[model samples]
Target chain A: MTPHDDTQQAQTRAAQEPIAISERELTVMTAHLEEAHQATLPVMHDAIADWDERLRSENDPAELAEMRARFGRPSRRGFLIGAGATLGGLVLAACSSSDGKKSSGPATTNTKAAAGGGLATDLKIAALAAALENTAVATYQAGINAATAGKLGTVPPAIVTFATTVQQQHKDHAAAWNAIITGAGKPAVTGVDTTVNDGVVQPAFAQVTDVAGLAKLALSLEDAAGATYLSVIPVVSDPGGVKTVATIQPVEMQHAAILNFVLGQYPVPNAFAKTDGARTLTDKIG
Target chain B: MTIDEQELAELTSRSRDVHNDAMRETREPLSEIVEVGREHRAHDEIDPLAGREFAKQRNLQLGKRVGLLGGVGIGAALLGLFDQPAFADKPSDIQMLQTSASIEVLAIAAYTAVLGLPFAGSLPAVVQTFVTTTKDQHMQHLQAFNAAATALGGKAQSMADPVLAKVVEAAKPGLTGPGPVLDLAIELENTAAETYVANTGALEDENAKKVTASIMGVEAQHVSVLLAVQALLSGGLVDQIALPPPNLSALPAAAGGVGFPNAFYKTDLARAADEGAVK
Candidate 1:
């Protein structure tokens, strides 16, 4: 580069430095997460209550039984059945079972190829994606709260900025998947994936006492989310669904890469993105 | 880290299938080529006329099986669309594989050159580790793509991307420190990541799409780390950039947000799929 160009490059590099974030910016960055929990959360609960009652009042036994027969699951499907089966066969699949049949040669060589096929599998995956997004959003929010309360002690400014920024992105991811769900005339998933919540997040997060601990906990979630997206893209039948998840996946990887740096690890740990951390598609949920 | 047993099994199965297919494809042709070579070597002078006759026969028989060699061999160079037997009717997957291998080749070359630089000697230990590990990864990626391509009846493109090789050459003279080299590395990585993201959707083969997407994730991670390092070097925190930070708390706040600027990785910087195809 010329002397003039070098001067410009220096200026560009300087511009990349983090500036002091305003309190309002941080709050906005967190999406007013406290207010979201205190105020909007109850509103969601109340609305869900009314929605649930309405469905129960109009509940049809024959349709519910048919939904059970078709879906054959209790946890994830009952909700979908209760929400109504206008989307009956169009939603849910034995994806976890079918996905198991395909060889990983890990993403292809579907020699046994058990996928029930099209839109149903995509919807199931969409539900799982939304749940995972909700899980991430909640995890970041908890991290922000713990830091703010001084429970983790002296949180770094850049990390706070990352939390606010990244959690909002997760919220956006959740909304994107929900939009696809509701667009199909089903209710949006408003909660985290319970399988992940109970088995992984809650158990691991309970041990987080310091910033390093919190960072590690968060990294696991980010890693799983990124890997899950990688596994889903090939099997998801719809072109739109594939595109939506593909776009969000790099962002998840970016999240993990940053976390790797905070924990004093090589940011890019593997040459190929691994599915070892990919969330298992349980016979029930998650 | 979580373990998905089924995913692991499938991964094993995938590796086995690729291995079996590669071995299966090459076993016969390799043997024929060897037999031909022995026949030729037995001749006292290996007559020029006889060599010419063998060449005509070899091209007719084993050329398609062995694939037109690339720069690393006889002609791993570009084959006409109709000439590729496995993917002749569908060359997009072959193009993606060839172009990816080309980029990996260029990455390996760039890092190898940087590692030998006078300034590179003084780079932070962690940075040195990053450079070496990333170079090795690119080598592995090159081998994987070439293996897949050769298995699919396409030539293994062991050549660096012609377009970006020139870009790296033009910038190498300006590399006063790790920062400048990091800039070049980051540029190549971001382009590869974005291109792979684009490739995932456009690739017709299911396995190819997943493989491309999987590698895209790693490339994106590389871009993230390099971006973070760029920020640190710019901030003059070279001493603080350790693998296990002497003090993670002392690392600047900017380190957190600097790594990931885009919520969605963009494809605007991606190279065209066939841009580096060995044509």
Candidate 2:
């Protein structure tokens, strides 16, 4: 393609899928990295008396509950609630509606009923993951859109390429989860988790006048995504489900590491990834 | 609770058939809700692959493949080593964990050698710091793998990967500088990453999968960082690898994408789960 054509193509691509790159994005998440790294390694298995005793006792509630608290129960406020806990910045929870009543905002309206009314725990995890991936896809698109609109100013070609690849990977991760959902005779989760969209992401996007601002949001986003994946692989029952999540977890982490580097921080901050801000099953899907 | 005996048997059956097929097919183990919580028999002497006759056959075969890839005499020598019952066509959680520990052993050894290079003390502070940190991380990974294995009633492997140890041993003399050293380090990281990736899909235990997958992410991160550092070194921006990189914009564009060349990390080049298992 000619230079003009290349520029037009780049512009079109950027408009379609924007990811603003900046140190601002990197800084938003580092505040939590120190605490996350310092988390005590949970050798939880050591707590069990024996395999048969542990397996036989549904009474064995402690480990499961301990783990579930790490990733479960999404609400419109939960996205930023977790991020606020981790990133140490920006409370974006939805509170007042246009008419001044306590309202759920536009987020709660898009909710689809849990597939078939209830899904298996593995399937629930899959659905929750699909929505998170969908939210990520939209998040990157918003960044690209902001950059293309000249709001972020002089978006670098390298940043565009980074956004493009990272966005596509999120798309793939969504598809993998959806495949499992659909294969199990459920509807594919086709919408972004509304809680993240309205409560956290939209507000964050409006504030991102520069690449760093947008990148900061994206970095926090990937940190949670990677952590959630780690949280579930141990308890997510299906081997296929574990494999699918396992493959994607590292990609999210790589994204975070690079962002950390861009932000002038240590790349791999934790010896092992932590679940401090991981998402569990969202109310969006059973 | 637990997986029913019939279902567990079916899973075992399915895994066996897959193992029989040249060990090329992916074997899905029993659902691990029961596996991870299952107690490791204290002092259990049971061999993980005792009954799977073809595991020995596959070992001989993998040894052949290694010989083909590395031009070594391993294939011909494998049978003599497995005359005992320790070998099998199927790798249980123990063998996989042992193999992982072995790789970690080799990695720590490689990094130690890198630190001991005659000029190592004078290497860039960032390179030296990275070498030291990564070695420590590998040591941690080794402990995690051995702990997981012993938890599952298996002996821990304390030796370096016999095959890759040879490769690293041969590559040692050329550890003369960052370029060659990083190249070997990347290979080891990729192999570790990819092997763990495959292990997540193959291992029978949920905790094993979780542990393997988490380590895989870090190993892949090592690859990403190493690749970025390699790019900086190649561009002759040696000073740029410094933590809190000297100047972000002054860095080359390759720095952006070099770290993650692929969108999805694959297991195509993954080392076999049994390649380094202690016999």
Can you write out model 1's per-residue Cα lDDT over B56-159, one digit (the tens) per residue?
Answer: 33233323332111222323332332243322232555667788889999999988998999988778766766787778777867866776555554578989
Tell me the lDDT of candidate 1. Answer: 0.61
Candidate 1 true-interface contact recovery:
0.43
Point out where model 2 deviates above 4 Å.
A1-119, A283-286, B1-91
DockQ for the candidates, in order: 0.19, 0.15
Fraction of the real A/B interface contacts present in each candidate?
0.43, 0.35
- Estimate how well candidate 1 is docked, as a DockQ score: 0.19
Query: Candidate 1: which docking quality band?
Result: incorrect
Candidate 2, residue A237: lDDT: 51
Question: Model 2: per-residue lDDT, tens digit, B26-142?
Answer: 011112322443533433444445525434543443443232224444443454545643545323667788889999999998889888888887666656666777787788789
Error of 1 at B35 (Å): 25
CA displacement after TM-score superposition, residue B148 of candidate 1 (Å): 1.4
lDDT of 2: 0.60
